[model samples]
Target chain A: MILHHLYILGITVEAITGALKAGTKKMDVFGVIIIACATAIGGGNIRDVLLGNHPISWVGHPEYIVITTCAALITILLSPFMKYFHRVFLVLDALGLVTFTIIGVRMTLALGHGFIVASIMGVITGVSGGVIRDVLCRDIPLVFQKEVYAGVSIVSAWLFLILHAQGLPEISVILITLGTGFSLRLLAIYYNLEVPKFNYTQMD
Target chain B: MILHHLYILGITVEAITGALKAGTKKMDVFGVIIIACATAIGGGNIRDVLLGNHPISWVGHPEYIVITTCAALITILLSPFMKYFHRVFLVLDALGLVTFTIIGVRMTLALGHGFIVASIMGVITGVSGGVIRDVLCRDIPLVFQKEVYAGVSIVSAWLFLILHAQGLPEISVILITLGTGFSLRLLAIYYNLEVPKFNYTQMD
Candidate 1:
């Protein structure tokens, strides 16, 4: 139940971020709403589609579309003051990332997938929305280019699996995974941590 | 059954195109294969996903992946001679587009969807692989920017629907759709037809 609410929060924050990106490209309102919704739900949609799961999350719950659309409109209205909330947005986004990862891991595991698939699904759920948004906005995906974003998701997923294997209470697993993932993401940002680059420009 | 064979040809041509694009970006062999598979099957994968269809095509028939992978590898070896085959590739690509569109429409109608959804799925299956390819290559989608690509898919889909509605035999509908779609695409190229651009740069 708590996970469900956090999922909503995650999508809302993601939508705002997507709307901001679309604004950078000066997309019309329709484009903004589309991008916002894609960033909000695209990850889970991709995950479930690849996993052969039916009735993708947004399809089953149209309310999520409403939430993302509202979030996009609100972001547009508040764009002038967005700089002031940059840090706050980042924190919220971090929270959303971990929440998404946890949910992805749980969902995949519930489907009887093994750890590898669950971890991949978790990372997919956590970052692929941003990937989709960046692709639509014509930017190289940030997840592929910078930061510990996917790394945080992988760690969170593994931690959840290990903790659950130890027969820990579900709530403890959730809280601990969320706290750890969130803190790790924040610390990475604070220290400007990044995965090493793989620059290949030679003719191949 | 003939559609099944055309589907294979479509993916092969699409894979070669994707591999060539990856080569331009100096992507490694693995990247080439990934792009190839994506270009070959990504459109149908996306359509089925959005439509809530299960066991996405490539998942159910993993041989498609193998076919695309081989196509990518062969493309790399044949890159030096690719210029000589430019026109041939375009013709094959046109065939692929119509084949994919027909398959998309039939699949959606089989699932009990209306013309609108079927048409949309047809376009998605016909062109979205290119969109996904361009996005991964970090270029704005060609379908959204230039040419009569998506429009051709839309026409083919609608044509299939209309002819089928006339109580035509399945084979006749498929042939007519393919021939018209293919001819129209070639004519668009010959005439240099293009959709009007949407250039919005004003600050809002």
Candidate 2:
């Protein structure tokens, strides 16, 4: 029940983030809605497709689409107010990252995938919406270079797998994994932590 | 039989294009392979996901992954030689566009989707891989701005639907779509044609 609420909040926050980015690009309303929906659910969709999960969650549940669309429209209207809420935005984004990773891991495990695959799936699910949003807006995927992003997902997912494997109850697993991942992400953001950049120099 | 070979060639060409981009980014072998495979088949994967088509083509036919990997490897080795073959590259790329569009249209039709959806699917299948490749390489997706790219796919797909609606043989439909798309793409490239640019101005 908590995870469901967190997931809903995460999708709403992510949709607003997408709309803000679209705003910078001066996209029309349709573009804003599309990017918003993609940013909200692109990760889950990618995870589902990777695991051959059918019907795609949102396609089967249209309400999620409505929620993200409304989020986008509301975000566009409140664009000026967003700049004052950087801390709130960061906190919500961290929560989203952990929640998405947990959901992705759970889905893959339910489908009988191995730990390694599930971990990767978790990372994909956590980061792919941002990737899609950035790519659609013609920006570099933040997961590939941003501060402790995909790293956080991979680590959290692995932690979940290990904890679950050690006979932890499902509720404890979710709560612990969520706490660990969320705290880690917030710390990374506070410290401005980053993975090492892979800038390649031309040899010839 | 002929279409199969054309499909192979088209994939190989697209893979090489992806590799060429990866080379510019000075990526390692793993990055090259990922981009190559993504460039070769990401479109179809996107279409399949959008349509709820399960298993994915590459998951079902793994040889595609191998082909793209090999193409990337070979491309890296032949980087210098590729420069001398600009015309050849254009021809092959044009071929790839048409082939991908036809395959997308054909797949959607097989799934019993309407002509409009099929046309969109065809456009997605024809252009998505390149979009992915561009995004991964931190370049603007050419399909979003390039001359007649997605338009050619949509047009060809619509043409196929019309021909099929008129009771033309499947083979004839394929040939006509392929020919029409290829020529249109070639002409667009030669003339440096472009869709109207949608440069947005920030209001606030």
Candidate 3:
């Protein structure tokens, strides 16, 4: 029950960031809304598609569409003051990522998938939205290039599976995974930790 | 019947182009194969996902994956001589686009969707692979910037719907749409025709 509300809050935050990205590109209002919705829902969309899950969640819940659209409009209105809220947004974004990762793992496991698929789904849910947004906005995906963003999701997903296998209560698993994943992401951000990049120059 | 073979040919051509793009970026062989697969199947993937269709075609037919991988390897081997085949590739690509668009429309209509959805799906099927390829390559999608690419798909889709509604034989509908669409795309390339680009400068 609480998780559902958190999911809503997570998507709303993601939508605002997506709208801000569209602002940077000077996209029209329609494009802003489209990008915002994509950023908020694209990760789950990709996951469900890969899993062959039908009737995508948003299709069944148009309220989510309304919510993301509202978030985008509000974001555009507050664009000038957005920089002042940068620190807050980062914290919220970190929380959202962890929340999304947990939800993804739980859902995948519920669908009878195992650890490897679960971990991939969790990371995809955590980062693919931002990747999609960046792609649509014509920027290199930040997750692929830098940070421990996907790494955090992978760890959290594995941790969740391990703890669940130990017969922990569902709530306990969620709380432990959330705390660890959130802290890891924040630390990575604060310390500017980055994964080593694969820069493959041609041998020609 | 013949459509199936055309579909296979279409994806093979798409995969080769994707591999070529990956080569220019100096990606590893694995990256080249992944991009090639995405370029060949990404359009249908997106269309099916959006339509909430399950068991994506490729999942059911691993042969498609094998075909694309083989195409990518062949492309890499032939990369040195590719410039000489540029004209051949362009014509093949045009055929692929029309083939994919027609298949997309027929699939959507078979699923009981109306014209609007069918047209959108057709366009997505025709151009989305290249869009995904360009996005992964960190380039603005050429279809969006400077081509009649998507426009051609849209026209082909609508034409298919209209001709099919006229109670023509299924093969006749397919042939007519294919002829007009293939010719239009070739003319677009030959004349360097382009859609008007959207350039939205922000108002301070």
Candidate 4:
């Protein structure tokens, strides 16, 4: 029940981000809905499909779609007030990110995948929707460039694994992972953390 | 046997295009290989995953990845000459698009989908790879903005559905769809066809 509500919170925040991106692109309602859904669930869809987990999450729970769609619609109405909520969105997005990674790890593990695979799937589940959203909006992905995004997913995923192996209760694992992961992400943001990057310019 | 070889040809061309795009972005060899494979086989991957088709094509036939990676390397070496082969690339891309659509339709219908679903998968198979490539490279999708790219997929998919329903020989169906779709795409390039698009502002 807590996990379900957390999933809903994550999807709702992600959908609003998607709608904001679509609004920036000045897209129509159809584009808004599509981008919103992509941001909210595309990661999970990709992860599940890649792992051959049947009936995908949204397919199994139609209510997720309804929640995301409604979230998008609400975002459309709330765009004028967006600037004031930029910091709020960032914090929510961080919370959602950690929540998504933990959920991903749980799902992949339940499907009998090993810890390494679960960690990878967790990252995919956390970051992929935003990648899809940015791509659709014709922007470079923030997860690739912004402060310590994808790396956070990998770290949190592994953290979940180690803790789970120690025989922690599921709720404790979820809460500790969520708290530590969210704080880690916020610190990364506050400090402007960056992954090492390479530039190849032989052609240029 | 013949269809398998044609599939190989299609991926080769798409991989080159992906390499060229990554070159423009000045990404490293690793990036080039990743983008090339995404462009070459990403559409089929997306289509299959969406339809719950198991053992994804590249996973089932690992050689496809090898081919695309080699294709990307070759493209890197040939980048200086890419300007001269603009028309050649366009022609090959068209062939790949149609071939991909046909393959997608066959796969989906084989899984017991109706024509409508098959047609949708066909377009997705035909165009999604390039979309992925452009998005990863941070460019507006050519399919959405350039002349009649995605439309060609829809039209060819529908054409294949009609001809296929008439009990045409498999080779004949493939050839005719290939010929007509390629020609139609080239003509659209030559004449510049466009779909209507709109920018939305206030709700009113």
Candidate 2 segments whose C-alpha is farther than 4 A from its true place = A202-204, B1-53, B57-131, B140-204
Q: How far does residue B48 in candidate 3 sit from its true spot (Å)?
A: 2.0
Whole-model Cα lDDT of every candidate shown, in order: 0.87, 0.84, 0.86, 0.85
For this target, which candidate reaches the highest lDDT against the unseen true structure? 1
Off by over 4 Å in 1: A195-204, B1-45, B52-130, B142-204
Give candidates' CA RMSD values in order: 6.8, 6.8, 6.8, 7.0
Residue A71 of model 2 has an lDDT of 97
TM-score winner among the candidates? 1
- Sort candidate 4 into its docking category: incorrect
Instruction: List the candidates ranked by TM-score, beginning with the highest.
Output: 1, 2, 3, 4
- CAPRI rating of model 1: incorrect
Lowest summed lDDT across 10 adjacent residues in model 4 chain A is found at A25-34
TM-score of every prediction relative to native: 0.62, 0.61, 0.61, 0.60
Q: Residues A1-204, candidate 4, lDDT per residue (tens digit)?
A: 787888889999999988888777766554566578879989999998888786677655657777898898888777777767888888999999998999899998998989999999999999999998988988789898878899889889999999999999988998899989999999988898888876777975
Model 4, runs deviating above 4 Å: A190-204, B1-45, B54-130, B136-138, B142-204
Q: For candidate 3, lDDT tens digit of each residue in A1-204?
A: 867988999999999888887777756565566678889999998998888776666755667877998998888777767777888888888889989999999999999999899989999999999999988889878777666888888889899999999999999999999999999989999999987777888998
B1-204 in candidate 1: lDDT tens per residue? 999999999999999999999999999999999999999999998888788776889889999999999999999998999999999999999999999999999998899776766776787799889988988998766664445777788789999999989999999999999999999999988888775432233232
| Candidate 2 residue lDDT tens string, B102-140 | 888888989988888888888888889898898887987
- Candidate 3 regions off by >4 Å? A195-204, B1-45, B52-130, B133-138, B142-204
Q: Is the docking of candidate 2 incorrect, acceptable, medium or high quality?
A: incorrect
| Prediction 1 global C-alpha lDDT | 0.87
Could you give candidate 2's per-residue lDDT for residues A71-188 as a string of tens digits? 9999988888999987898899889999999999998889876676677678778988988898899876666555677778878999999999999899999999999999998988
